[model samples]
Target: MVPASSEATPRKRTTYTDEFKRTTVARLHSGEQSATDLAIELGIRRNMLYKWSDKIEKQAPDKELRAPGRPATDELSEIEKLRRELAKTQEELAILKKFDAYLTRLKK
Candidate 1:
């Protein structure tokens, strides 16, 4: 029979909040220590800290709604309204052209 696995099983993944990220990065930027020291103190990976810092620097201040399972808001109503207005303008141009043709025929 095969021996039981010698390697340790993988650990479950964990998540951190935005607040935690901001606080940890702030501590790193305070100039009192390096990322390696901070990572050890915080029980997290140094690379994770670096990734968070990069994200914070490139982030913009905006609130965007994200939904993975639903369709986005519909713009079809506004598009249909503009299309109707365009058709009305085309009809008016056609009437004006017919009147011009009638006037020219009368003058011939």
Candidate 2:
């Protein structure tokens, strides 16, 4: 059995404000410094900074919507709706072609 003194203590979790996250992400996007170096300077984890950057990009209004992390349920439903509409349109087009071929046969 291990001694009680040998057990490691857990580190506390830190929360950053939205403004801090936005400015940090913007600085990273500017390419003035590497993420590793910036994270060290800011005293935050590199992976955390990357997550903030991704979140900021996803929130931009003019940017194309991307699937960040798992897609939301609403987005999944919209994609399903589009798929159904495309399938129905393709079926209708095929029927119209067959009808046109039948009409041509009658004319000949």
Q: Which stretches of candidate 2 lie over 4 Å from their true place?
A: 62-108
The TM-score, computed over Cα atoms with residue i paired to residue i, of candidate 1 is 0.50
Worst 10 residues of 2 by lDDT: 62-71
lDDT of 2: 0.81
TM-score for all models, in order of appearance: 0.50, 0.54
Q: Write the per-residue lDDT of candidate 1 for residues 20-69, one digit (tens) a residue.
A: 98888777767577899999998999999888876775462321221123
RMSD of 2: 5.3
User: How many residue pairs clash in each candidate at the backbone level?
Assistant: 0, 0
True lDDT of residue 102, candidate 1: 100
- The true-versus-predicted C-alpha distance at residue 28 of model 1, in Å, is 0.8
In candidate 1, which residue ranges exceed 4 Å CA deviation? 60-108
